[model samples]
Target: MSAAALPAKPARTPTTPSARLAWLDALRGIGALAVVAEHLLPWFLPGLRPYWFNLGIYGILVFFLVSGYIIPTSLERHGDVRAFWISRFFRLYPLYLAVIVVMLALAWWVPVREAVPRDGSSVAAHATMLLDVVSVGGVADTMWTLSYEMVFYLLVTALFLTRGHERSGLLSMVFAAAAVVVGLVSSGAVLAGGWPAYVSCAVFVVALAGVVLGRFRTAAACVLGLMAVVLLLMSSRVPWLGVAVLAVMFAGTAIHRWERGTGRLWPVAVTTALVAISPLWAIESGWWWVQADVWITTIVLAGATFAGGMALRGRRLPRVLVWFGLISYSLYLVHHPLLKYFVQISGDLRRAEVPYQLGMAALAVALILGVSALSYRYVERPMQALGRRVSRRYRGGLQRGGDTGVAGQGAGDHGVLGHEEGQVPDRVRDHVAQVDPLR
Candidate 1:
């Protein structure tokens, strides 16, 4: 769709930074609920779960789009690789490690899934947050998405360092085209097992040190980016799907570029079409959700939802959804494990009468929301604040030390929100901090 053909941004609504971000929160809230429902219905209300589209996939796609829209902007706004990575580390890790620890602590009572490799390799992959790409399973099923998020971040950092970030539109189509070719030639991961995880973890650590310490920063970023691509293409459990997910994310970036008048909408449109069909022949024994019609429906719906959010970006969104958005990251990570534990205590509700099952589902959701809100308050919020402080200190030190490299001041673009160069709004930056690794 052309920019002119899209829905007009409502002029009457004020474009305050918070107002601009509310729609993203709303989307995150909706995505989080959809994911929770997807997990819950199968165990608690299997009869009501719709087969028309995969709710989990829908939620994940929405999340990746949101991440794509905001993440690079966050890095650009900071204009410092050290600050950006520090912010990311604190924003994502504190809660992520907590969740993993909680799950492991409970493993004696509720064993970890057999899909997870019980080895040091799992630790290595999880430490890098590149679990899926390295062919190691995460402690939580939802965590596979984090691998892609990490890959995108690495690639974006490389693009930023090399001044190639503006070619998001072209990159989107490239990934999409690669997805199609990879699907045709390869159905499964070729570089499987523990070595990929160990090697990736080592590269991730050394490369991150090089980037942050301002020693061959661009080279470090390029190496990391190349490794991310290799892992996605040769080591991911589903190579085609991995590339396609990256395509969808870059398409989101293309849409942002189009909105900012830096890019045309045609690439986004073409990328969407390509990704929709990229998985048609991806695997020999694909699940029902990946069937052509169902998969296309899910992709189209996710695109429409993002488009809808963009259209309504200027308007005030409902508060409940905004609240959901605030607690969404915690909600996303916490729900599945809690659901599994609840099922253990309550037994399967799938055989129960509809009303009884629904009541139980509602109860579970309430508990999940309550816990998520607390985690947001006690965990995510504090860690994010700490990340910001650390980022500020690092940037301040860089300025004081006259380290005017890419990891120093005034190094990145005017970010996606159209802020003046080096003048990213505090409200927008804070809101962007809440970009869930997986909503």
Candidate 2:
């Protein structure tokens, strides 16, 4: 794969300041449905489980790639670290905490996996959402992905603060190479057993907190290096999967950089090919990735899907799908728990006939969508408005506290989509990302 094979970039449009990126919304919509289908079909209608296509993993990797692509754009588009966190906090936590309550209540009735980490550490680690990378059992199995997402956030923020975000392509290449080499040489290594994982997790959390708290900039770099090194070395349950996931995410970020014209397409192509093929080395000579019947199929399909989306950037998509994208975060959160509870309450999932189970799955998706639409309307939208309001007040208030942000008004926002936030939170909604509403 090379730059020559990639699709031509779309022309930039002259639009209003508040213009929405429909392509990302469309991508998120399709990806969210794929995830819902993947989870439901396999769980209920086991007879129809396709051995060849890994819809769940495919959906999730699309999410990771989209997150990688859009998150950095959101961050740099506003160029205010505080405001970015505010948007993320309101965007994610309101729905996340609500889902937690639902998950816990459902667990009481439905008999979900309640595997907590030893010694109550799971509580603290999960409170921060760094459990899996820190080697703690997640509250939900789906949550494992969030750990990698959080780490990616830290790494990107560090790069931006250190004025190195423009080099994301090189970094993506480095992560991909590490994935290949590490996967090939050995399975992988965890940092330390037991308490050390917790301790390191705590340290990283505190450092991140400090950085987000508008403290010294050095704290940002410190936490970034510490967490990155630890994550690179820590593989725990799976072998090179962590590295591979990170590589995939960074590959997204790399593509984003190229799309914005600060980077070359060649590195992005190289990184994607590396990420698509990296798993071959990680799969023990005999075993294969749980996501795929054939690993290459997963990579090829994902690449094609993304490239196709890129090629048709300005095209119009169905209204239903775009609306689904609007409520994707709520859908992603509540769908799993509702489905799990439905199974538990129904009792004897395996005993149900394929036709009956398929009907139930469809109903579950319908219910999830209805509830998600309401959640998005009543919950996410209002909270997001509050977040933006809070962002405005927070940035203005920082001046009173004598905390000059990462950079002052005069600094030109330099990287991809980076802008001079002279007003800080200028067109703050630009930072609102519909992709990977994984929160």
Candidate 3:
């Protein structure tokens, strides 16, 4: 559910400062806090442990919805599938690769390495970061979400390149309905574990082809289509929850399309309703179950929080919340491994005293925050700037080289989803005009 950066910045044209996307930052901050709190609070405040009302689910779902709402705009901003991929690559991979290296180094000294499945094949599969579709365990507990995020990217690109992007609402509804059906009958088994490495490797190669081979538009589109199909069909470590999550993301894209004038609000509303009601379907379908009343209460509360956030989207949040939003991605990525390491290191402290437990938990959280802040500054932010620059260069090269394809040509790259070809409404245009752009 984490994002590397916000959409590319827009040309500065001053407007009402308070009527912007600080609420989105606040939402991210809240989700980050909820997740972090879910992890940390249990260590010190064991009485608050309630699996049925897991705050982690709430936070992650919020993050997912936000991604659905905003991510498509980035594709439209670049107007080139290849450019978008390049931007995403620079935005996401460098830091991810860095973390992987760090984790591998830690394996030399700590038993933490065993947390991930150990095998040559499994290691190769994870190196691709599409482990969900490939049906492999993650290097860390949270890395599984990255695979789903990758699938969303592939699907969005597939739809956009195929000119079916405007039908996002319809597709979201279909996915939700299908998910309900699948939930009722599907065993949620792994598709096939035998060739996961090969399939994952092929997808990676084809994805690169789709990005770089602009002249072969038909082939690229076909590759994208195949990629999307494979992603949706493959097994997930989380089973039916993965399918449900995709539906929610598509619902978000539907809302973005409505705001862009490419689709209608009613369809968005309907699809969103489906996504909101999915947990009940999930529990009833026997895919998973929690305490009914408690789970229902948590779901309702999560929806209310989401609705409230959307209603107040135009309002600016406090500086601290905005700051938290800025560092949330880094926080999400780094916290779990740190938590695991400390939980072991401080085993004796857990039995020592209540005060020690509180102190230890607080200290762990503070250390995580401190490390996350530094990582955001050194890793995420620089890479984001580099991504923007690389995207621009790639687009410029395509223009100069006269390889204008489905992505659109220079100057002709009108904002297809917006009012004018190149012009977006201020609401969408103001997407990147913030102190720290919400990702």
Candidate 4:
């Protein structure tokens, strides 16, 4: 059928279970926890460790994969490019802005004897999410990842707006690939000139991975395997490649379903064994490869763990982790600045001994959790609701103007409500339309 002549989707039943994509939530939670562990590494161990076992880095790969999987789904479901952008802005911007503002306030007000010197340029770049582009020192080291995320958001938004037509997907893929080649070639030169070259390279790798996986599902698995080998070889030269590799693997895994049986145990066992051995090897040899191995093993373990969790779909656990997943983004953005502030406030305590450092780390985590919960409950949730309402109204207006397309469907369908596949009831469609007057 011609695209314009396609019929509207039939309304799903209201009594049907809601689609809740818990896997994404669980993955997000895992990412957040990995970041927390990465930050707390120094406190837990002696000396200034590079924090290579840092699951947080791999968690970003998961983030990218999750976004790739969900954005297309959102476009398919919502059918409105404007609404998708609106929802994304609502979901990400408020918390991001709030974190920036809070960080600024702390930087301005907090007194510290040994504060990292803040450059005006750096502050501006970070506040605008243009730190990587501007080559400014980030307000927080972790903010580097946010720069890549912002770029990815823009690219994905473009793809969503174009609705996979105009060969926009192909165009995006080409651009992303070009970016990687350029970044890798220019990174060393840029660094020699005193710029943060790794940031560009990292962002390009992420974008390239997204494009490759989004475009070629069958090759996705092979690409991931190849990237893993490259990452292992280049761990010291381009540590970020390791992250890209993990991301590719995660994306590949998400695209394919492995048979559920006792046979899954072998890979899980090997992955677990590798993860367990990695840290020990890292501590003993102080080799970067050991560190890389640790992260790779962790990513494998995380994948296995996610599979296991999915297997336990219906059973209710403590849900504390799931709750953490809900606020994971906020937690991640806010954690570093909060940690910096804590270090400043408790400098003397931190320097006391290993036990004291550990204690401070615990206290920092508690504060982050508390602050993130409040941010989610009061700030993020309300903004999200407002964004959805605005998107619905805007799209509804478009529909009334005779724009009868799938874009009339609300953004909630694209995994925003954390719904899973096969869970969206036909009846719920009517309810959504009645309630929002836009879906």
| CA lDDT, every model vs. true structure | 0.76, 0.62, 0.59, 0.46
The parts of candidate 2 lying over 4 Å away from their true place are 1-5, 16-20, 112-114, 185-189, 283-293, 349-354, 397-439
Flag the better candidate by TM-score, 1 or 3: 1
List, residue by residue over 67-142, the lDDT tens digit for candidate 4. 5445545554665545655666677667777766666676566532121235443444544353434444344445
Instruction: Name the runs in model 3 displaced over 4 angstroms.
Output: 1-19, 112-115, 260-262, 276-295, 348-352, 400-439
Looking at model 2, the pairs that clash are none
* Residue lDDT tens for model 1, 60-121: 78877888777776666666778777767776788889999999999999888776888889
List model 3 lDDT by residue over 1-439, tens digit each.
1111122223344544344456656677777887777666555555554556657667766677767776666566555777666656765676667767787789765544333556665666666667666666556545667776777777777777677776777877787676666555544444756366556667666665755657565456657556655555555543455676777677767766654567655654555455545545552333222345544455455555655666565555678876777677777777777776777676534345777777888898899899989987888778777766665666667756654344433432321111100000010001111111101
* Candidate 1 runs further than 4 Å off: 1-14, 400-439
TM-score computed on alpha carbons, candidate 2:
0.84
Q: For candidate 2, write residues 314-349 as lDDT tens digits.
A: 666677866766677777777766766666666545
Model 4 whole-model lDDT (C-alpha atoms): 0.46
Task: Give the lDDT of residue 265 in candidate 2.
Answer: 74
Which candidate should be chosen as best, given TM-score against the real structure? 1
Error of 1 at 339 (Å): 0.4
**CA RMSD, predictions in order:** 6.7, 7.3, 8.8, 13.8
Model 4 ranges off by over 4 Å? 1-19, 44-52, 109-128, 161-184, 188-295, 309-317, 348-358, 400-404, 411-439
Worst 10 residues of 2 by lDDT: 422-431
Which one is best on lDDT? Answer: 1
